[model samples]
Target: MEFTETLLPGVGVRYDGQSRDGQPIAIVVAHDGDVEIVTYQRTDPDAVQYRLELAAHAALAVAELLGSPRVSARLVDLTREIPGLHTRRLVVAPGSRYAGRLLGDSKARTRTGCSIVAVVRGPDVIAAPAPDFTLLAGDTLIAIGSERGLEALAELLGLTPDDPVPVMTAPV
Candidate 1:
């Protein structure tokens, strides 16, 4: 989708875009960390149908809820080009054996044939993380491999074969 951003002078910034369904939507962020979400009427783009005002913290929470599914969908799309390849985001749960260990020490690639493409630690995304990268509790490991390889990698990460993969929800 295309978006237009405008400076609101002393007020803040306004971002306007059209949704996939052709409905107009806007977000206005004030200088004081307040946010306004505006949705225009379907019949008249210029007419406001709904508006939501939120503080910075509430906006962040909403963003997280909406953004994670999109990210997960994109990851699945990326792996579609390669046959027999799958991508999964595995979390490093507390009490797991891999926590506080170096990526090289895990030998996940050598043993399971899965590759750790990135590591997500809170708000930071370490792309193409090196072998020296340290695994920690609450870290999200982005792994790409075959189905069997991914299962093996989960086993190596101290998960049981029956354990459900902890990651973003799968795309519908």
Candidate 2:
């Protein structure tokens, strides 16, 4: 089955599972060294376009208007509620080791409580990554997880401590 719905501004690819209400919401929990894009047949065409992983009801109200999930709702809160949680950011450039493979697999990354919230690849922005996603050179990954766990991911991906982000250097 195919859905012809327009690509909402924030609705890109789902990376996780279930919205806060226990409603079915797929999200891209991580984008470490791979690219994960999930596609599911919207069981209901009239299905509410607004879906949020927000832990609160207030943000869900705004999500309804956008017809797509807002990333801020998933992140940011980590600092407040997660006490001692760490968000790991991986910026892959030409020389970085993760230049060509799928990085974000929920089962794999989540093992360490790290989820990939965003992947900035060139001009496009991917919301989340499902398993089997691969990462290419010059991709910027914004991941959230424990500090130690994230550090391990950095090593596995071959990202050094002082590499510049590919997105910032790309000519505008």
The CA lDDT of each predicted structure is: 0.76, 0.52
Model 1 alpha-carbon drift over 4 Å, by segment: 1-73, 159-172
User: Could you tally the backbone clashes for each prediction?
Assistant: 0, 27
Q: Give the TM-score of candidate 2.
A: 0.43
Where model 2 places Cα greater than 4 Å from the true spot, the runs are 1-74, 104-113, 159-172
Q: By how many angstroms RMSD does model 2 differ from the true structure?
A: 15.2
| Alpha carbon lDDT at 29, candidate 2 | 27
- What TM-score would every model get versus the actual structure? 0.52, 0.43
- Writing each residue's lDDT as its tens digit, candidate 2 over 38-85 gives 334468733445533443344455455645444543565555477766
Cα deviation of 17 in candidate 2 (Å)? Answer: 36
Which candidate should be chosen as best, given TM-score against the real structure? Answer: 1
Error of 1 at 150 (Å): 0.4
